[model samples]
Structure formats: structure tokens, C-alpha cells
Target chain A: MTNIAEKLNISEKLIATLELEKNSLAGTAHIQAIRKTALGSFTEQGLPHRKNEEYKYSPVSALFKSELCPAKQNACAKLTKSTIAELRIPGLDSHLITVVNGFVSEDLSDYNPNAKSVLVYNTRNTAKHAPALFEKHFGQYASNDADAFIALNTAAFQDVLFIQIADNVQVDKPVVILNVTTTETASLASPRNLIHVGQNASVQIIELYVSIDQNASAINNSVSEIVIETGAKALFYKIQDDCPGLNLITTTQASQKANSHFDTHTVTLSGSWIRNNLNILLEGEHCESHLNGLFILNDSQHVDNHTLVDHAKPHCESNQLYKGLLDDKSSGVFNGKIFVRRDAQKTNAYQSSKNMLLSDDAAINAKPQLEIYADDVKCSHGSSTGQIDEEALFYLKSRGIGSESAKALLMLAFTQDVVNTIRIDALRKHAETLIEKRLSK
Target chain B: MLSIKNLKAGIADKEILKGFNLEVKAGEVHAIMGPNGSGKSTLASVLAGREDYAVTEGAVQFNGKDLLDLSPEDRAREGLFLAFQYPVEIPGVSNINFLKTAIAEIRKYRGLPPMEAKDFLKLVKEKQALVELQVTLANRSVNEGFSGGEKKRNEIFQMAVLEPCLAILDETDSGLDIDALRIVANGVNKLRSENRSFVVITHYQRLLEYIVPDFVHVMYDGKIVKSGPKELALELEAKGYDWIKKELGDVIEA
Candidate 1:
């Protein structure tokens, strides 16, 4: 195995090094056990290459060249006041959690401690303490058979977040998780998060990613695993507005039980290269899942979205819609797949991907597919990629709109379909403002 | 105030309008009645500066300016408006927002300040009432999911908002019921002023009965073969365009 690791290329070498380095954590038995199990799985599977079906569009080989060490736990290394001020949304100052370089900082977070049903633990050290609880749930859902990146992420789980909501508890305030990356050197960082919602519990979680420095070419490989127990509901929103020099790979895997509902919205605005994988597994009957995303790429940015909805039980419903606006030399890729097992009868699934190319040089590759093995199911998939309507443009121009303002108006209208899907009013307004700013530029 | 002399236009290499001539004065409603493929829409598109229609020869003068030299947007700012037969459906852009932008843009072109939001909303309400458009429909995306009558009324509403010096309604009466025709015609009548002119392009005489053009022209084979008073429309409706074809057939044989 060592000889095979040495013979492999740069990405393989990085994976091998990460697998070997997991043993040197010198943490408690639980952390060690989890790391060893993940490393073993990674060693058996290795990193995914271009030949892998799931990662055919996103290549992660370039991320392995840089060496990234686990961030040190420093209480004084908190986010600045200016940075916190800039991270303020319209109505999101009450419940916020700021994580800098994978570690949660107390000064930057505003979560109230008096909430009886909500519990927030910095599992970076908790995993070392509670070995049984950590081992029981960690790395149990994401498989390493097809995705090498997920395997590598499991193998190198550094700082982990564990959020638990008690049974039937409803949190009125939304939770905002701000992930800020400020690195001057070439490095890799993985921020692992796990969310558990008990029976009949409901919550809203917002994740924001921003870069502090522009010169550093950092690699962000993060994973968020969520479990919605029976009759639970979870709404997850992720906003990726990182600097153009960063490379990002994020995976969100969610599991729902009977009568549960889960909704995830991902908005990608800026990144040199980004790949997002979202998977919703309906493990019980009468489960509902909604996946919505919007990506606006300019210049030479590349954004790819690969999503899957697995209906394992009967009477499950899923809806997915992703839209992309590509300008300049940017490129976009969207591949959404829905699967219904043989026994998952009465399944209703709908998926659509629409893309608009602003320039002739910009390109988009969209594929929305469905695989249904059940006889009593309603499933449909559609994809369309085209330029803006010339007649519409002429209509606006003939109404005295200038070329730029006309383009901006049309682009804003194009993105409204996806923005209207947001159920949260504040978040929807914020997304609209960000989209307007990008289109104006 | 508008003159098109020896105007020849076409899409690609196939010419549609050959040596067409027309003159429209201020405050006059001139209706161009033609059969299919007679280039009625082409003349309106050319006047409104649609780039798809290439003018091979001749020129169009609008209010002493070279209309052919301006882009569609510039021509629009110069007080030229085309009420399309098939108004575009722009999803996500509310009708109020679209109209405000259009009005603001035209005002800016004329060296005026932006309108106050309160004043603009007031104007929207007024014009919307003039067209009998529902307030709910005005708040939605532009012409999205609108009925045929609603779309035509929305076009008239926009024409009223912009208050263009020259308005061309191209087949505005097509696909309209009698009730819709009355509402649309009433809206046009309310917007009629001595300072503004209109060119109503239609195929049937039914629309002419309501809008009541001052002059009516019979266009065949891309050129106007005869011109007369408003009664000509009634005559053409009775004769059914074959009279002009036979009259030209004898000329060609001679």
C-alpha cells in the first residue's frame, strides 16, 4: 500500500499523506478511532480521478499540491470588528456563529446560552471526549465507494461542529454560520459540521463563506451532514461569495425520516473554481426535499453543481431547480439526478436546470436526469441552455432603456424565478440585492 | 412631421418593401390597410428603428432628424414608440418597474431629472385606469400570463406613460374581441392630442370603425396603390382587396 501510494500522482500523494497524518493527531481514543476508520476507508478507495463518474466534471488533483495543516486553537485569533460588521445581513444579528479557519471563536459568535432545547458544541475536542457518541454518527452516511473527495474529507476531519435540537423544539431565531478563511500561503482546510434534529423539531441554518485575503490560493473541502428525524423540518441556506483566488469543494448530505421535510438553497457568486455536491436521502415514507441553487459566473470563474435526490420509501416528494448566468469566459455545469427505488411507489420528483449565457464565449453544460424503478411514480427532468431573448432586449430598448440598464433588467428578471423560491423573506431580499449588485457590475 | 421617401427594406436578401413612400403629419391618424405580406409591419418596424429590417435605399425623417441613423433606444428617446402586435412577456420584471425605467430613461434623454416615486406611482395609477387595467396585473411581471385583451391594453398603457410624439400601433386590433376593441380604442382616444400623431396599421375594417383613421391607404405588393378618405376602408372591406389586384393586373399587362 505504501509503494502504491508513492507511485500515484500529486492528488493521490496528498491523499496518502493525509491518511498517514491522521494517526499523528495524538488525540483521545474516540477521535483516533474515527480517524483510523476513515483513513482505512480512504486508503482502500484513494482519491477520485477524472475517470470517476461522480467527479467527471470537477477535477480535484490541483488541490493536493498545497500542504495544509490543522489550524491551531487560539482564543485571541478572533474575527475583527470590521469583519463582523461587514458580515451583517438585514435582520440577522441575534443568532450568529462565526468560525474562523475551522475553529469556533467565542467573541465572534452571538448564540444565546439560555436556549433549553438548542445545544452547540465545538466537537473538535468533544470528539476526543465522547468517543462512543462521535463514533456512532460520524462518517456513517457519506460513502467512499464512488466519491474520493468525500473519503478524503472524512479522513481529514479536523474541526467538527455538532448542533442538536431537542424533540419538538422550534427555534424562532435563524442560525447564521459565517466561515471566514484568511490564509496567506497555499493550504487546505476542512470544516466538518453535523446537525441532528429530533422528532417534530424545526430549525433554519444559514452558512456563509467569505475570503479575507485575495492573494492566497486556499482549498476549502468542507462537508455538512444533517439528520432530520421523524416529522422534523430543516431549512438550510448556503451562500458562497469567496474571493476569486480560492478553490472550493463543498458537500451537503442530508437524511430525512418519516413525515420529515428538508430544503436546501445554495447561491454561488464568486470563486476561481467551485464544485458543490448536494444529496438528499429520503429514508422514510412521506418525506419532502427541495433543492434550489443559483450561480452567476463572470470572468474566468468555473462553477459546477452536482445534486442527487434518493427516494427510498413510498410517498416521497422532491423538487430541484438550479439556474446559472454565465458571462465573459466563465463556464458552468449542472448535473441533477433523481432516483426512485423499486419499492418507493407513489414518489413525485421534479428537477430542472436553466442557464443563460451572456456572452458568446461563455459555455454551459446541463444534464437533468431521472432513474425510476417504481411503476407508480411521477418523475420528470428538464434542462435548457440558451442566450438572452433578442426580441425582449429590443422591446426594452424600444421603451428607452439603455443597453446596460436593459441588460441588467433582463438579467435581474432571469434570476427572479430562482429567487422567488426562497421561502425566507429576509434571505430572499438579501439574495436579490447581491444578484442586483453583480448584474450591475 | 414624418416622411419616408423611396424606402426599400427587407430581412436578409429578400426585399419586403420596395420604393415605399408615406407622409404623416402631426395630430393625424393614418391607417395602412394591407393584405398579408404587404410590408405594413415592416414599415412600422423601420420607423421604430428595428435593426432586423435593413433599409437598402432611401431615408426616414422624424421631426427634422435622421431617423435611420439612430438605434432603437435612441429612436425611442426621440419620442418614437411602436406598440407591438405581440408584446413581449418579460418575466420577473414587474410592469410598474419596467414602465418607470422606460419613463426615467426617456426623461434623462430629454435632460430632465428622475421622477419622484410618489409622482410616478400616481401617474401609473392614472394611466392604468385609462386602459382599464387591473392594479393586480400591473404589479405582476410584464405581460406574463396576461390575456390577449390585457396584453393589448398594457401596450396602450405603456404608450400613455411614455407619451411619445409619434406612436405606431402595428396590428393592435388583431386577436381582439369587441369589448377589448372598445376598451383599447377608448384608451387610444383618451391619449390622442394635437401634439402627438399615430400610425394605426391594421388588416380589417372593423378596427377602423372604432379608431376612425383620418386617411386610409390600400397597400398591395409592398406599395400603396391608392389613397383616400376614411370611407375608403369601408369600400376596401366590401371589395375585399381583389379590386386593387385586378386594377394593377391591367396596368402590368398594358
Candidate 2:
């Protein structure tokens, strides 16, 4: 019940203690070393405040007041068959992994026994084996230099998934990961995951979040880092559909090598307060990245999406489109930025954010920005926030469509551009159903 | 089917239509011709119940009801149609869908059931042919990416579907080629019947050559300065509006 200022003071003290403990760990000079260093940096940074450029509209002090603790060692034991059934999503029965309370459950995961090109390992004990690989790449792309929430995630990291795709291999089926949380009281849980795609490899990954109980007010802090090597391709999707009582903060960072392709779709349905930070860094030439998002919020829900695409090499391309529908007293925010470095010539980057407020009290704040040091690049950004056209409403209402039904139809049509971007037909249909349900209510 | 008495309307504080009066009985076609700034379009807008135009004085009666008192949608529901000079292009709504909504709204106002989808599609096809509207245009977004002629044809096609008791064509022939003009006028002529009335507003007498008017009224400076039969249009066409100016000047001197 502490105010946000007092809560932040306590969090700062905790971060100091965690940092001192992290510095005392003397592990093998391997990949774990890098993780440990990253953890130390995160502890020093702590959660972001309102002053941070990236987290301007999304404040994390309120989240810290929950006093969240890491999931228990046997947290996976609480996951039951019924829980999995309730969390079942479209095209999710094929090959999937279920992580409950930040711990992986073998019974809930589908692993291919004879799969040679794909490898999935538990990085929960990264201090022991595979230290060298973890040290070189762990936290390299998702740095704590700018964002405090990401740093806080690195400081409190516990169990995380490690996935690697071999060169020249193509995974026919997508990898689905469901992160479920159950809390008895106000607490915080940080779940971290890293994915690496080798050169010329192709894969698809989907991450989903859910809450087991509706009334439990929990702060779910999650981070994911992905690396795509030269000529590799990766398709990533993250779906955030939690109960209205849960406060969720998620960060995803990705790096693309030469001629690599990375695409991500982030869809948020409803939550008490949700913030997502997605950053993509094109480190090699001819790399491509696309980031798309859609959110539908109602009541007093608040959803904020912050995305950045960094073009470091020449001849790179990136496109981003985020659409939001806010109803009742809901509020939505989108801040998308594209930075083209001085050497990144001929970088084609485009970003657009469009929002529709269904009610007079509903609000949206969108800022699409571009910083181009290279003059030859084709970079543009646009943002628009408005209500549904009244003339269009009258036009539809005159056709015998009742006022409410006409509003719903216009809203659905307005969101078609974002919904149709879902590559998977089943997932797309599922998202459409969720949207219809949200609009109907 | 439509009548207006002492209609004084304006936007903001500026009175545009000062004590205007008009009447159109069923099966009659009345043309309101005027020079520039004649308030011909303002009369059409006031009748259609555009919220921006205030009717400070007077009343409009349509189908034995007070038309001015109803909302625009309600007026449309009461079988009153105004084909805008510049039809709005609603980007995502299809023409067929818009027409169906209009028809259904009118029907609902009359306490009729919604039309079956199959029957509605059949009706759309029939109306499209009646106006020579392309099938592709009907399927596309309403008036979006349409040529001038196509937009006008689409408006008339909407009228044919709604079957309004009173139809007001506001400068419907402003931007049409000769062929397009003929096609549009022919569509309007086909929709004329004993149960419906027409109010054609235009600047020139060209459109009247095809859809001949029963009466013609010359509007000047926001008021009707002259009224005559169809021959007045011919005489005006023969000697331009300057002749009317001279006639007005001579009357003032007397």
C-alpha cells in the first residue's frame, strides 16, 4: 500500500543488494560470465522511471510496488491439465512448450525426439555448462544501457529457454511457448528467454502470456532476446491476453545479420496495465525487419507499446505498423522510432501508428518518429488518432444497421489491415474471434 | 409530394435562402435554374436536413409530414433523397452495402422486415443495370476512385434502390460529358413515376434538354426572379443569363 515514490526507494535498495550479490559470483570464464555481467548491469540500472526516453508514457514505479519475488523452485508442479486446456490457442496443439511461474514443465512441452536441426535446452543453470556460448551472446543485443526495465529483468533472471537452429535447416512447424503465472498476492515474476538462428536457417516462434487466476494482481516482467545469423530468417509472434487485474511488462530484443530476415507480430487484448518494448537492430547489410502490433482495450485498461528499429548497416529495410482500438475509459499509447545510423545508407524504413477511440472518454497517444543520419535512406513516419467517422456511421446506420452494430462493423473494418498481417491462418482467425468478442462487449 | 413555404435558412448568421417557397406534387418535374450565388444548392441542402444550414423561418412538408423537424437520417427514412453534387467517398464501405443500408433504413421506418440477402443482391443487380452502373463499381468502396460520371450514376442508382417519394438532384450534370449526361438523365427519367416527384437544381439549361422539366424558375441573388414553363429554359439558353439581367434592369427603371 506504499506510494509509488516510497516503493521506488525500496526497489532501489533491493537492486543495490542484488548487484552486490551478483558481483560476488565467481563462475567459469564462459557464457555464464556474460550473463552474470549483464545481470550486474541490470541491478545497477533498476526499473525505468518516467524520464527515460523509451519508457516515457509507460511508468514502471507502480509495477515495483507489488514486491514480486522469483517463482518457487517447484512452481511447475502447480500446472495442471486443466490449466493447459484453458490456455489452448489455435494451432497450439502441435509443438509447444509451457512455462509456468518462470519454470519449464516437461509434461506440458512437446519435444521432437528425432529432430536433428533444432535444439531446445534449459538455460536455467547457465553458470555450469555452455558458459562460453552464453557469455558471448547473452545480453549482447538487449543491453541495459538505455532501458531500466530490461535491466531489471536481467538482474532478476531465473529460468529461461535456449533455442538454436542449425545452418541451412528449415523448421516446418512453428515453436509455441506459453508463459502462465499464478499468484496468491501482489508479487513480481521475471521470465527470460533467448533464441539463436544459425546462418541460412529458417524458423517461426510464438510467445503467449496468460494469468491463471483473475483477481490476483501480479507484475509479470518478461524479456526475450533473439539472434538471426547471416542469411537466416525468423518469424516471431507474441500474444498478450491476460486478465484485467494483471500488470504486464514485456521486452523483446532482436539482432539480424547480413541478408537476414526477422518479422514479429505483437497483439495485446486486455490487461489492467500493460507495457511492451520491442527493439530490432540490423547489424549487417541487406537485413530486413518488420514489426506489427494490434491492441483492443476497454474499461479502465491501459496498454502501451514502444518499438525501435535500428539500421546500422547499409541497404537494410524495416517496416512497422501498430493499430489500437480503445473503448470506454481505456487508454492506449504507441511510440515507434526508427534510427538510421550515419553509415546505414539506402535504408528503407517506414513506420505508421493508427488508432480509433470508440468512446468519448477513451484516449490514445501516438508518436511515430524517425532519426536519419544518412540522407540517401527512404525513411518516413506517420501517426493518426481519431474517432470513427460520423458520416460513415450515418452511412451505415441508414442501411438498417443499428447504431451499435454499425459501430462494431466500422471498427472491425478499421482493424482489418493489422489483423490480416498475421501469417498463420489459424492464429489470424483466433485473433479475429478475440477482436469480435472484445468489440461486442 | 414535397412543399416548402417561406423557408428562410442560412449558415451561422448569414441568411442565404430568404423566404423561399416551392412545391412539387407527385409525378411532376420542377427545375430551379439560377445564376451564380442563387441559393439553389442551399434550398436542396435545407430540404435534405443538413445540420449546418439553419432554417430560421418556415416549414418543409414531405409526404404530409413536417420534414424540417426530423433528423437527416429520419428524413431519408421518410422517403426523401438528395443526390449531392459532390458525393462523399467513403473508403471502405461498398456501394452495394450503402444502398442496402439505405433501403433497409427506409423499410425499417415503415415497420418492414429486413430484406433477405439473396433478394437484396438481386435488387442491387437490377438497380445497377437501370443506371448502367458497372458491376465492379458497385462492389468497390462507395464513390472511392470513381470518375465524376460514375459518382453521379452511383447516386441515381441509390435513388432507384431507395425509391424515395421526393428526389432532389443537386447540380447532377455539372461535370458530365454529353454521353454521361444522357446516361444520367435517362436514369432519372426512368425513375420518374406517379408516386414520386423530382426537383432538379442546375446552373445551365443543358440537362433539361434530356429530362425535360414541367416548370422552370430562374433564381438570382438568392431569390427566384423569373418563373415560366419549359420554353423559358429554351429562351434563356438562346440568350444567356445577361438577357435576364437586362430585363431586371428595365423593370427597376420603370
Candidate 1 regions exceeding 4 Å error are A1-9, A12-27, A62-78, A125-135, A214-216
lDDT of each: 0.83, 0.80
Give the clashing residue pairs of candidate 1, or none.
Answer: none
Looking at model 1 chain A, which ten-residue stretch has the lowest summed lDDT? A69-78
lDDT of 2 by residue, A1-441 (tens): 446567667676656555555544333444345656666666566566567766666666655664544445455445677767667675544467787766666677777835878877666544456534555677777777667667766666566677778899998788888887776655557777888898999998888888767335567788889999999999898888755567888889998999999989998887789988898999999998989999988888889998989999999999999999899898888998889999999999999999988889998889888898998989888998888887667555443455675687678777777877888777889888888787877
For residue B118, model 1's alpha carbon misses the true position, in angstroms, by 1.3
What digit string (tens of lDDT, one per residue) describes model 1 on residues A1-441?
Answer: 643343355455556667667766544566667667766677777666657776666655545544555444442333576667678678654478877766766678888755878877676555445434445666677775546667667677667777778899998878888877765566566777878888999999999887777235567778888989999999999998745666788888899999999988999998788899998899999999999999999998888899989999999999998999999999888999899999899999999999999999898888887898999999988998888888899999999999899999998998887888877788888898889998999
Predicted complex 2: DockQ: 0.24
- Tell me the lDDT of model 2 at A282: 94
Give all TM-scores, in the order shown. Answer: 0.95, 0.86
How high is the DockQ of candidate 1? 0.84
